[model samples]
Target: MKRARTIAWIKGLVAIVVTAVVFLVPFAFVLLQAAKTPDDASNLTFSWPTHWQFFQNLRDVLATNDGLIWRAFANSAILTVGSVTIMVILAAMVGYVLQRKASRLNPVINFFVLAGLIVPPAVVPTIWLLQGVGLFKTMFGMILVEATFGLSFCILLFRAFVGTIPRELDEAAVLDGAGPIRLFFRVILPLLRPVIVTVIVVQAVAVFNDFAGPLYFLPGDENATVQLTLYQFQGQNLSFYNLLFMDILLITIPPLVAYIFFNRQIVAGLTSGAVKG
Candidate 1:
């Protein structure tokens, strides 16, 4: 018994150590590089900077291209918020219906939803479709794209979570003369806060940091997202490593902070939803 316990403890410690080293090494390197003076940063070596210029690097990153970084940040915010809001609400409602309603088409619909998980998106066709709808190269178009791409995962999570909820609650709400909308908003939604938070955090991070969707679906300088702004610090021949790292550090803070603070909530939400019918 003692030997087994000791082995498990050792395994856990090794896993923690490996995880920490994997995540923290690159982060520490970026932090150190971002703090270096331009000359020192240009070297791109691991040695400590003789003169730290964290503020200068931040200012440079922000001020470049007439404050384009801020605009990219704003675009990312709009995309993240719009996509996540719609994703959460629609996914939750649809998940509830799918879990509760029994119909001939339910299995077919469920199969397609599950199929969405494996099927890769056709970028060219999506772009052509958006163009036909006159939404191409637009922020709204990108928002819809991000939402659609994330919808399947969100629906699955919500469906699993909703199954764990008692059907008695729905019946109670209906007995009280509540409609579907009221039942969902007033009764079921409040109970779904945990999984909802998980969806929001995960989807927000994914959409905010996404590079390819914006790159392919919404091209051009005006529609550039935070991830797109990384190119600004790099040129054909030369690159500003300091400003580049600073930009990365700036754009990375929100999701990093979200995960750091709500990590426990994320875990709880994910695990709590596993008690399916």
Candidate 2:
């Protein structure tokens, strides 16, 4: 017993130290650089700022290019909300159907869903399709791209979680004269709260921090997401390290806060259906 306890204690200590080094160290470095003057930050050493310019750096980041960060925040907010909403509704509905019904197409549909996760997106084909549909470089188009890309993962999660739910509920709802939509929206969806929260937080962070998606499908300053604002402080020739770190700090906070608050839910949702009851 004593040997086991000592081993567990050592493992726990090592885990904590690893977590701090992996997460806290970089965050501290970014915080230090963000607080420094331009020249001090340019050095990029993980040391304290000689002269604190935290607020000044913040103001500069926000005020760069006539407050592009503010616009980027709005665009990212819209993109995240819109895409996650579509993903939740569509994924939940499809997952419920796939779980509750046994059909010839189930295997084929499952194959396609798995394929979506395996196949790397062809950027040129996606761009051509968007242009053909007249949705290229548009907010709605970007939302569609994000939603489509995230759909497969969300569907798998929802499907797994649905397995943990008893099918007797479906029977009861049907006997209660509920229609298909009512049965799902009123009964099934409410029970899916855990997975829904997981999908929302995970996908929202991905969409908000997606540099490539916005850079490719949604070009132009008018459609900039928060991640794109990093370009404002960085270029091929010149870079503003202070403002760059500040921008990273700002954009990182929302997702960090989300993870902090929903950490437990995320774990529970991901592990919910792992073992059959």
Candidate 2 C-alpha error for residue 9, in Å: 1.8
**Residues 177-266, model 2: lDDT tens digits:** 999999999999999999999999999999888999999999999999999999888889899999999999999999999999999999
Candidate 2 weakest lDDT stretch, 10 residues: 268-277
Candidate 1 steric clashes: 0
Off by over 4 Å in 1: 1-9
Q: List the residue pairs that clash in candidate 1.
A: none
Whole-model alpha-carbon lDDT for candidate 2: 0.94
Across 32-145, the per-residue lDDT of candidate 1 in tens digits comes to 899988778889888888998999888888899999988899989999999999899889988889998988998898898888889999999999999999999999999899
lDDT, each prediction:
0.91, 0.94
